[model samples]
Target: MAIGVAAGVSVGTVISPYAGAALADDAAGPSYLLVGGTGSSNIGVLRESGGRLIPVGQPVPTDTGTLSITVTPNGRFAYVAHTVSGTLQGFRVGDDGTLERLEGAHLAPGRPIVGAVVSPDGKWLFATVGSVTNDVQTYAIAPSGALTHVDSVTIPGATSGLSIPVVSPDGRFLFAPSFIGATMDSYAIGFDGRLTPTGSQVPTGDRPALPSVTPNGKFLYITNEGTDDVSGYRIAPDGALNPIGRFPTKAIPHGMAITPDGRYLYLPQTGGQSVNGFEIRDDGALVPVPGAEAPSAPGHLPGRVVLSPDAQRLYVIDTLTTTGTAKVFTYRVKPNGGLEATAELPVDTGVTFSDGATGVFASLGPA
Candidate 1:
């Protein structure tokens, strides 16, 4: 059994990549949806066409326990962090949105990875590993989409449960939240892609799950699952987070997405089984968007919420459900910051409730 998962629940089939050459081109490409889940190796590759997701080809063979996937802003590369196998895999994104495994792009950390994300400049990849070890690894991204270990840092005072890290829009700051410590830790990113402690540890609500920064890079918000509220922070000149205020939400807000313009914020409440909308005030406070409560399908627990690159569509993936099924809920962004139901795409089945699920929109267009 994978670490932290209950007995008898499958994380996926153990698979390895075949030796392959890396692609050298870095041109803009088409958008694609990459989906991975808990119990099966249904690595979906879907392209967005005419307001719907069309399957590109057969499921891509990948390592088991692959719950998180992060793509570069240029859409030239994608990275997968395998929780079960304790390895990091990189792939060169083809022009047609297919994934080609890059030779020498795999790294075995020998511990479970919580998540991985690329810096906005695509120069560095940061991954969080181990529930108890609290280690963060940094890798440099080559032009051929290969990875080389650059640095590793252990979060200070983090006893356990180091959540995923989020980089600032400017790529100068990295913020990581610790559930057990109930604190949000900030780090300074050196030009060489190394991390240095910023000495800024801001207290957050109980069990803070994810941290999100607005596109303007002026404010940061974190979804506090244990407190059933959202914490707002102002990004100081030095990348320190200054508390704005704590705003109330429905219940158990796990994941969130902010619009490109930084005018609206949407959060998925797993306990409430619905998506809530809020207007981001000029001072970094959140005010509920009137009539923006969008409910999820019965028995479905929404996990990760992501917005299309253009900010016209919103997608939420179900982390757990009782119907032996999992799905991605798509919505049209209304003018008033509300969600208009568009379509639901069923992705997999027999998925037990996991704390996090991977759902990312890969922008394939030119940088």
Candidate 2:
């Protein structure tokens, strides 16, 4: 049977045979895992062939209930943060793009693990512990891709707050967004991977959800889920957040991503069930991308937005349904940072075979 889903100006087809065969490619690419509140914890391997997303292997079972995931820069390791268990799990990527469980399955620090990221050097891992404790934990990543506990420091106002941590591209700073405190806190990273607060917290909008640093390492963007806006900040040399501007967006701007060239920022509005694009000016102001808002189907809670490594395609994950379904939206990014939709591919996470919460595209790296 063939399934037809809306892609922007036209309809895209998903044939069962093609999907099944695509799932058998040898170079099906690295496995992308998705974790959430449901019990659907599995890894998806995708191959970008013929300008299409081809699934190569079957999903592997990861027992840890992951709320978020981050893959290492080398794509050899994937770390998942479990919200309920308050731990992190490490998995090694095999040749076939399958995941092999490492020794560190559930390393908990007495708090819920909301976000985790590998350092730019791939030497250390940091995770945000979203507990009343309000601490960011550090771990030394072994050569075998295992994590060893290193140290942790508490954010002064992070207690009972949702601190989302992100490491800068230069490997010099780590920024954590505190929802309850309404602040974006900065920390200077020591050579040994220890974090020391930089004594600066730039206040942000209500309920800041996720923080993203531009690829150029010059600016930071945070999504305010409660306010339906995105706040931009200029990165100071001393690891300080200098407010650039706050731009209004659709309702519930949950997930966001900056293009590879650092010219465009994509926001996925969960409540509005739409995707909005913005052009980044040289002065750190965001101008809404013309003709970029695409309506989504009902119950399509867009969770995360990511661009292809080549910067040719845009992908959004829908999180409302239990069956994993990713709305793969392709776009032709113009020279001026505007976006035009090319096609949309609806991928089944092997849940319904027709439509269901299959899995989310957690992170996208090169093939």
Candidate 3:
């Protein structure tokens, strides 16, 4: 049965089939995935339609060891990073938004993996490995969505790290926020897809986590879990980051994302259990937009925030509770950077999953 989008209601399902792709060709209104805690170490896919989030398919298990997952720009495949297992799992997307495990279930590089992301061109995949081994491994995407390790680069002081690696929109630079070091490092992506340290590390507030780039590729934002602030950096031509502003957040900011229109930013403060919205000024500074805070319901721990392809809706994922149930919230995006509740629904994963279920969903839309 097909899930219908109702006003201000969350809906979900667990099945594998190709639902029709009926989004407009506006370059901004594609469906999204809300990857978070699953019953058994897996990720969930939620399709956004008319400001509501409906479960389009079943949760795809990443085996034991995968922690963070990210989809390519085209949304054709997803890369799952297994922090404990030191492997990355690749999954191909079926027409109905369900995931099918690719030929290679595990790409083991013998390093503790923290995050994985596909390059803007979707030709390569990058994984950040830390703890036991502090390095970034590069892999070429095979035609069948499998990964073949190409090269690896060791960061000087990345021995203690947690944040995932992020590539710039231009695909010329890479940013990795190290929680242990409390800094964000930059690297230059060479022509051959190799990474070269840019020798520039920007000091962040404290325990910096995810680092996201702006839509225009002019600014980078980093969320500091320890200091309760978001740091902004201006993107320099030579792949260097210059500080723009460091603004205070409500509490512990975890996940963050810039809107598709490049006008607003959304960050989920886990400590306060609220989502903070900001207006992006031309100078790269962020000002909290009025009426932009969305509080998480009781007993829900919000994990990440992402925007729909059309920039008209936002999705927030909440990891499951003690009883083993997940949730995804949908919001209508206002022109002035405020959010209105559309739907808040619970997702049922057939099994119980743990902390390794942290990941963000993506759609096949514009860069």
Q: What lDDT would each prediction earn against the true structure? A: 0.76, 0.67, 0.71
Worst 10 residues of 2 by lDDT: 1-10
Q: What is the TM-score of each candidate against the true structure?
A: 0.87, 0.83, 0.86
The parts of candidate 3 lying over 4 Å away from their true place are: 1-34, 320-323, 343-359, 362-367
Residue-by-residue lDDT tens digits, candidate 2, 137-211? 889888777788788887776343667678999899999887777788899999999998885778888888888
lDDT at 145 for candidate 1? Answer: 82
lDDT of 3 by residue, 43-146 (tens): 76766555556666566655445557777777777777766555666777654566667775356655567777778888888888767336787888876787
Better of 1 and 2 by lDDT: 1
Candidate 2, superposed: residue stretches over 4 Å from native: 1-39, 158-160, 322-329, 350-367
Give all candidate RMSDs, comma-separated: 5.1, 8.5, 7.3
Q: Sort by TM-score, best first.
A: 1, 3, 2
- Candidate 2 has a TM-score of 0.83
How many steric overlaps does candidate 3 have?
9
Best by the TM-score measure: 1
Cα RMSD for predicted model 3: 7.3
